[model samples]
Target: MNLRWGVAGLGRGASFVEWLSAIDGCEVVAVCDVSEAALQRFDGLQTYSDYSEFLEKSHLDVVAVITPGPEHATQSLAAMEAGCHVLSETPCVYSIEEAQAIVDVARRTGLKFMLAEDYIWMGWCQNLKKIVDAGKLGDIIFAEAEYTHDCRGGMLVDADGKHYPASAWGSREDLTPTWRAADLPPLFYCSHTLGPLLYLMQDRCTTAIGLNTGAKVAPEVCPVDMESGLLQTAGGRAIRLTNGFCIAHPFSLFTGLYGSRGSIRMVNLGGLQVKAWFEDDPDGGWQDLAMEYEEREDGHHWVTVMLEEFIAAIRADTDPPVDVYRSMEYTLPGICAHVSAEQGGKVVEVPDLRKS
Candidate 1:
């Protein structure tokens, strides 16, 4: 059965809809965006300026909530209530209330809900998962991940919706901060850093304590420059996550896993590279693992793989790999981490919304 798909938000959603349309059993039938200019991009497909009207008219079997971070929770719930399954972008819910609400509604409606956390499906991450599963990394006792991309370049928008760097706002009086520039504390956007770590360890965060390097980089436009979350799993594993968008750094995603027997690390400094050392290896020194492709190709490959898995789950009437509960596991810790950061690194418990 070809599932009818409607996409919300045309910025990233345009790319997603293209990929969804390319899938054999998925049809991109509708798209919704507040901007008429964006809607015009998908000329042949149905488009809407208002989301509610799109939901009513699209007759979509699935809705991809790829809007802004703050809009994800509300949009996902509305789609599920409208009798459509949902595939939402990361940091799925902004608050614990939103998380619980999504969990409740998804359970009550028996609809499929998946978080589009493609980082976990990256080739290096997948390789790490395989090594961990094979007991090469032993028991993962601690992990660290960082996503320090400099986003200050795209932080401001003019009245005409033309984006400019945060620095450009000084010359233009009509520039406004983009949603991402002034969004939640940086740690709240830690899914990219935390998701792949947890995916490899197969654990959920139970508690988190966080700290932030206050908005020193782009204080005028950005809320926070950098934030770090120290999370603890139920099995006594520790995971450290650092997320920064406005900091002065070349785009880098780094992860290091330390286990009882050995450790492995992967980073995108100049390029993607993985280093590993196992206790039982003949040589006791770290060895570099060959990375097949750069980050761009890896990203495209993962999103395709992730969408295929989601489509397969929807067709089989089963839970997606990153279902509602796991979505919260990947997301809620960062929410609580943000709270912890606000409270001066007080330990915050991540609610198990599955029980609620």
Candidate 2:
């Protein structure tokens, strides 16, 4: 069954359209954005400046919410209410309240509500999970994940030119206004680094202690504000997540897992290295087990994998790997991490969303 997708937010939605255009069983039947100029890029598809109007008129099976971080909940709820499934971008919702609302609506509607956390679907990350589950990494203990990018220049440009922060794409007049008219925390954009580790471990993060560097290097550039969080899981695993608009570092998104018997580290978008350390001999030192590269013309193709999984879940009548609840679990740490940091590095207990 082909999944008819109505894509929202043309900036990032353009990539989804490009990917769906290539996939056989998926179709971009409708597009929506506040910017007519951006909507004009797509030909022979229904376009709308208002999302509510698009949902009411478009014959869509799924609405892909590729809008900014803050707009996910409202748009997703609207789609679900309109009798369509929703696939939203990472960090599912800006706040726990919004997350709960989306979850409640999905349960009541019995429609698929997936969080597009593509890092968990990366080829290298998936391979690592397989190897670890196969006892190649023995009993896992500690893991570290990082998502660092030097977006100072971009932040400065966006803030000065548009009078909004770098990550505030929704605030752009060209985009639809689905976000709450309130300020958002920085650590909310951290699923890319946290999702992969949680999936590989196959366990929820029970507790988190976060230390935020309350340093606003360029307040003018990042007027929305930002902070970094260091989280420690209940099982004594450590995950350091950093998200800010004005950091002075090269872009990096990677995870390193240390187990009782072996270790594996992956440097995504840098060198694409997935190396494992295993006990080679009883008397000797450890050895490195490297993963062979599978070349894709367009890098990892994570978003494509996510869409494929969504379509397969629809066909199989089962929840996707990154379902609403599972995705919520992955996202909670990011939310709590920010709270922890704001509270002067205090440890915060992540609410058990599975229960309530």
Top lDDT model: 1
Tens digit of per-residue lDDT, candidate 2, span 93-187: 87778878888887888899998887666666667767888886777787777776765434422312233444554455453212311234556
List clashing residue pairs in candidate 2. none
- Per-model CA lDDT versus the true structure: 0.89, 0.73
How many residue pairs in model 2 have overlapping backbones?
0
Which TM-score value belongs to model 1? 0.97
Worst 10 residues of 1 by lDDT: 291-300
lDDT of 1 by residue, 1-356 (tens): 79999999999999998889888988999999998888988899998999999999989999999998999999999999999999999779999999889999988998999999988877777777778999998888999999998888899997667899999867978998998998867877878888888888888999999998887888889978988899999889999999989988979989999999999888888688889999999878999988642333345667888999998998889989999999989988988888998899999998877677
What is the C-alpha local distance difference test score of candidate 2? Answer: 0.73
lDDT for position 220 in model 1:
88
Residue 258 deviation, candidate 2, in Å?
Answer: 1.4
Candidate 1 — number of clashing residue pairs?
0
